[model samples]
Target: MTKKKLNFCFKGSRDYIHGTDIFNELKNCFNDSLNYENTMLDLSFHGIAKKKLDIVEDNATDAKVVVKFYDTNDDKKTYYLVENKDDIVCRYDYAENKIVELSKIDLDLGKINLNKDTSYSLIENIVALNKSLLENMFKEAFGKWYFTRLQLKKIPLNYYLIRLEFKSNFNFKLTKTEIFLDNESLGFIYFSLV
Candidate 1:
């Protein structure tokens, strides 16, 4: 019996917004409605597992946004707020780490400035947002397996790369998966089952 290795890698840019930056922008947009210090204290107390803000600029005057927050609480809940232009379309709370569509919550949104520059914080947020997706995709491609190593690197042209290696006892073939965002090519997933 021989031991085999499965390698999965994704390379490209998703242009994700930094968690802290977006949180600050939200605080500013809401004015006195959102208390900065108190919110920060609550987040510190509960701990932040993941945060991501994805903004899509439709035209010169219109934009759509999807903001998500995952906290390290006992419930492991995920909260999402979706906004189109200046109006919040809907809000959802996913409890127990399950993706369920629930009732809506009201949130007022104002003008938000999107940052296009790439930074380490943005990379970390992107990783946090996609970690579960990557795991699910890996399982779909090669069945359930535990990864042995993980590596992340910042590359040129505002792109980030991630690699995950898993040890296996079965041999398979090479496979490739393309990751996209709004019909645009964002990255790719390459893996070899061996």
Candidate 2:
């Protein structure tokens, strides 16, 4: 008898599909076969900066939200950030299926003018609008596990990033799932089980 191998891959996106719509796209990626054994899941968002802010001081030309994973023999930590085009976010050795190096860059919040009235309003609205759907997605993906922390960062006139960390009920370790949003509205959601 021969064993069969399964390959899971999903890439999708659309305009005017922000909050729950994006969540639904993710939910459908697995086609009702999401593996609950994975211990952690991280979601990163990348989008165009709204025109209302002053972003010239930062000297940033292009930006994207990316999640870099550091996988050690013992543990793994997910680092999510909005990266400028000049920055080297991380190095991946596809043959080994792990990240070789991760370079961290701290954003100069002082240089960019973050309008108090509108800072993070986009992400805040998306999160607020899809809170329940996110909760349900977490439950469906992790079973007894729950999300431990959520982080949101706004890059004035560039991009924004969101990170969601999930906690497992048991101590077992496995490859974590990562979802990357390549663009804000006309975005591409890339899901990888590894």
Candidate 3:
């Protein structure tokens, strides 16, 4: 049986829609499947994921993510790349490249209920937000995550910005990624460093 890799898709985004990060995650997972050196890696995020797995690799460049994905059928695939390190989300487009895919994303803590109160520190707030996000996604998907990489440019940030990437286990990218969120969750905010 093929194993399922991790995927990203859940609730808590005002502008809820599948972003590029998910695409890149899926792209890397696909690549790993194509090149399997370890038989012990019987399971990789190959397709339809509900679990999350982090695949770290070497010699990866802006053209490819340093991570790989494993699927439920024990198959592996997916690739990733980042236009800039500050970019948070990844995108995918199979027709654009070979083996792996790429994308760039920026996350903004835009107008939300983050609060003007000094009760929380900046780093604390960011980490807390990250924790909440991780919890929310895992809760909904049963801790599963399947993503792919694409070439989606971010909306552009006002000040400075950051970015990240991921890949999937598909030769071709998926149809779409849909995100959902509440207003206070700050899930709708989107931006890029450019």
Question: Which has the greatest lDDT?
Answer: 3
* RMSD to truth, every model: 21.0, 21.1, 18.3
Segments of candidate 1 deviating more than 4 angstroms: 1-14, 35-80, 83-194
Better of 1 and 3 by lDDT: 3
Local accuracy of candidate 2 as per-residue lDDT tens digits, 1-194 = 11111112121221112322223333344334443233223344344322111112222334222222222232443322222223222222111101111111112210111122323333332333223223333334543222222222211233344222222222322212121222322112222111
Candidate 2, poorest ten consecutive residues by summed lDDT: 95-104
List where candidate 2 sits over 4 angstroms from the true fold. 1-15, 37-39, 48-126, 129-194
* Sort by TM-score, top down from the best: 2, 1, 3
TM-score computed on alpha carbons, candidate 3: 0.18
Candidate 1: C-alpha RMSD to true structure equals 21.0
Pitting candidate 1 against candidate 2, the one with the higher TM-score is: 2
Screening candidate 1 with a backbone cut-off below 3 angstroms (N, C-alpha, C), the clashing residue pairs are none
Query: In candidate 3, how many Å is residue 8 off?
Result: 24
Q: What is the C-alpha lDDT profile of model 3 across 23-141, one tens digit per residue?
A: 33443545543433232111111232222333333223432232333434555443333222232243332221110112122224211123232232222233233323333323443
Candidate 3 local accuracy as lDDT?
Answer: 0.28
Q: Compose the digit string of candidate 1's lDDT tens values, residues 90-121.
A: 33221312211111111121111112322334
